[model samples]
Target: MSTSSVVTAPWRLLWRLGLRSSPLALAAPLVRTRPDPDLAPVALRAAGADVAAEPAALESAFPHATDRIVVLVPDTDEDESAWLRHLDQVGGTYASRLAALLDWTPVNVRVSPGEGTAVEVATTLQALVDGWPVPVRRIALIGHGRGGLVLRAACALRHQTPDAWHELVSDVVLLGTPHLAVPAGRTMVPLSRRVDEELAGIVTDDVVDVSAQPLPHARYALITPHTRLQQSRLGGLLGDVLWWRHRLPMRPRKARSLFPSATLHHVPTHEIGLVNHPDVHQAMLAWLA
Candidate 1:
């Protein structure tokens, strides 16, 4: 943490906590150098309403899949769009590119992951994988926002079953995932006020420490924005039930990997667009290659 960022963290927290009262907004734009977004003309649209459920296994599920698969885990948001469509919007494109690069087929979990804790999500993910009835030699996980945390937790959750799918994940890509709490000027996007209601309840005070018991046989690439840490600048400041916490504060803290050995890529974009940003996707493709 830089001296300026550390010194200013508490005040930033105050502004983030109080929402509108803090002078941090004007002052932040002044003191903190906001990175140039340099945004491409991308349609940053939200997904539409939900659709009826469909069969789990289609006739051509993973037709190009061999002994390898790349799974895209998207954050559970209010976007009621079909899971597959939303996944495509978020990281499915990168997944397809990655799959083509490595001769792996991209796929999503059998069902939309319902409500659960990280461990519960992990177990459910594994159960769904087990039921797939497909031969798998290796697995690669790429997740955005909270979905990244779920994927990390699943990787950490040891599997007792013989030759489990969890054991096959060789690579993990975390897009805009917070891995710490009350970060000191840690580069991250703040949780949207709305995400707190649905996501905050479960991820409260939870920490996915990559430092301890590092994921075995797995390489990690954490991609997040270089922008300021806080989000919800316009939303109401005061939240009920303490909604500010995350898996924890994540990013390059003090010019180093907050995730220790993991390679870090910083991009210029909003949290959601981390998956869409070219720097992020390019770094992802390079890392996997």
Candidate 2:
């Protein structure tokens, strides 16, 4: 073996062994800092609702649109305000820049309590869709990270309920979503994977082989970044290996199979912060068109 290969082989072996026997494999729930209760109210307001308001009460805040209704689902552990701010930075406020880009009313949905399993988020989304005051002709869902999984679950729920929301959904956009499984590590994975087996269970149940059971009548798009999870030299190498095995084209390929007509976009970056990238936003706008 070459000198470099000889030196790295032992480390690779150790990593493989660690992953197999690590406590993380047992799927223990990650301990997270308690989110500020105040943030919840802020999130609700950003979504155009009062903290105490019912889902139905928030509907009037969104203008009725015959062209389409666009809903943005933020990443796990993110507040709606953060996403709204991102939207404003990328385009403008929903009524101005986004409205021009999409030619539709854009809405943001806040996942209550701020953090949870995909199923919990999906339940909230279903309620949000059910409570819409205006009829939906065409709907588009844009989700980031675990939010994408929540969108898929919401679609599944719609299938079960036979709602206008499902029938109206024209497309779903997933941004850096880990459809199969994320890289198996604590420091390298996102908050969604750090959650208990709930996240894993949902992904495995819904998308382990989604190509076999794709959502009906809606186009899908998977967008990912070519990013590194680690910065340290040794860690970066390991991260690259894990990323190549887990991230890369794996999730997107699965998505394409699931939705044979699905489109895939790769952003040149080192993280999942695509919301701030104008090119990514433009790509999504193009996809919507």
Candidate 3:
């Protein structure tokens, strides 16, 4: 362990103890809510819910038209309209910006809230790929949070049965995805086990062992935030402990061993929000390119 880890170990323990003393803290599971697969979008739509928009019309602005397509998947409980509005408001014309910066065509996939699971979302993506107007020779799958998990599931399905869409995937970019498992502090686990068996089960089945089962052939990139709120610091530390306990980072490393290459990037940002940062946009542009 590093010197900083050794120094913080005692502090982490104290924080865990303090957190355990609270009944409210102990009541809730440390894991994120299960994604609702029912909300998975049935079809791809323009960012503003313009079903009438043509893919060709959207791609017309690109100076250097290429067969490459970039698909954006939002987090759980989010869809394309909300994602696009947020990106435009904070990211400042991110789609157009990316189009202007790269040769690839950018589009957003609308996923339903509370009902989009990895497998279901993957099916939706596959359908999009099958029906795309152009012959998609290359694709870059960009997902945020749970959406990343969906992409992984899609890749896994493709791996099982090779198809045109699977063959075309050139890049998979995951932003702030907890690939190994969701980080619930060490202290919460014992409390959860003692209090609610159902919560404990959820933590074990859904949070603890959620792996991407990443494809060996595809290039992958994992991006995380370096800066988070102090309130979530203990949870982050405990999450790291869970990672250590399970030897989790090894999953990605193993995937990297099989692929052409894989890269991990940590962008400095507060909390789970990094999509709007100019640095993040630049890094993504560079990576996608």
Candidate 4:
């Protein structure tokens, strides 16, 4: 054998062996580790993500407690019961539980228009609070996504509407609501584009500058949930891009800036899903307690 061949033989063999042993080189990217069954999901809401879900009507919706009521706002692509879905599957609803704690009943606001107008929704809430035939004692509000904006609009009208909303709303909890401007959605899908348009319309018409404006007689809880990275279809290359694109503009600082009096709780997991999570329930209850 030549001198050079002999000298490189051992090195070549080691390199080949190393390739076979390395997980990244040849092995399939399977056997991904998953969390334990007991693992709880966590999330945070950023200010730039706007939800475009349609809200519901008042009388036909959830049961109401005239004396005491807890109102929950559903985020994008969700309804009034969005917060209750997880808890309902487990046992009861977080809203009802919270209402019970404060001797209140859960009430969700749904606008008359099927498509949902922000002004109408806010007006309805104000009317309810102001027009209650009986003497109402306690009222609490929990809003997810765009619901937060609507509630803020409702509360902003405390003086204009003659509703004791400012005085009645004892506690307010916001789940990842976008109280400020959301991004112009880059989603290429046609349906998603329509939703984005609707959201933009709401931002233009419904959004109020509640910056540094705290609701009167209300305790604020602003919870932010970090979103999980979705598995990418193009081997995660595109997936990572899309994930950051949606989440990058989301800033907890925006939420904090909007509600200075709010007690902020951030969960850097998958930004809250389309539905509510139980761990969030515990967190809100603990805060109130």
TM-score for candidate 4, residues paired by index: 0.54
For all candidates in order, the CA lDDT equals 0.49, 0.51, 0.52, 0.48
Q: Which stretches of candidate 4 lie over 4 Å from their true place?
A: 1-66, 111-116, 160-163, 179-212, 228-256, 268-276, 286-289
| Candidate 3 per-residue lDDT over residues 117-227, each given as its tens digit | 455556655655555566668888877766665666567664344555667787787776544433344554543232222211112324322444566667897765442
Which order, best to worst by TM-score? 3, 2, 1, 4
Candidate 4, residues 1-289, lDDT tens digits: the string is: 0111112232332242233455354222111234233421111111222222213223323235357767666653344545555554556567666766645556555322123344555555555655454556777788776567666655665455444456767788887664344343443433323332232222322234544266756898776532211222222321222222243445531112456678766543222232455566677667555
TM-scores of all models? Answer: 0.55, 0.60, 0.61, 0.54
**What value of lDDT does candidate 2 attain over all alpha carbons?**
0.51
Once model 4 is optimally superposed onto the true structure by TM-score, how far is the C-alpha of residue 8 displaced, in angstroms? 43
Ranking by lDDT: 3, 2, 1, 4
Q: Of 1 and 4, which scores higher on TM-score?
A: 1
Report the lDDT of model 1 for residue 169: 78
TM-score of 1: 0.55
Candidates 3 and 4 compared by TM-score, better number: 3
1-289, model 2: which lDDT tens digit per residue?
A: 0111112243442242233455453323233235556654223333445432344555545545344668777765665565644554455543344577667777676553232444454554455566656545778887776667666655665346666456777878877665553223343554333332232222343333353444678888876543222222232333322222244544431213333456766555422245655666666666677
**After best superposition, candidate 3 residue 245: deviation in angstroms?**
7.3
Q: What's the C-alpha lDDT at position 70 in model 1? A: 72
Looking at candidate 1, what is the lDDT of residue 17? 31
Query: Where does the lowest 10-residue lDDT sum fall in candidate 1?
Result: 40-49
| Best of the two (1, 2) by TM-score | 2
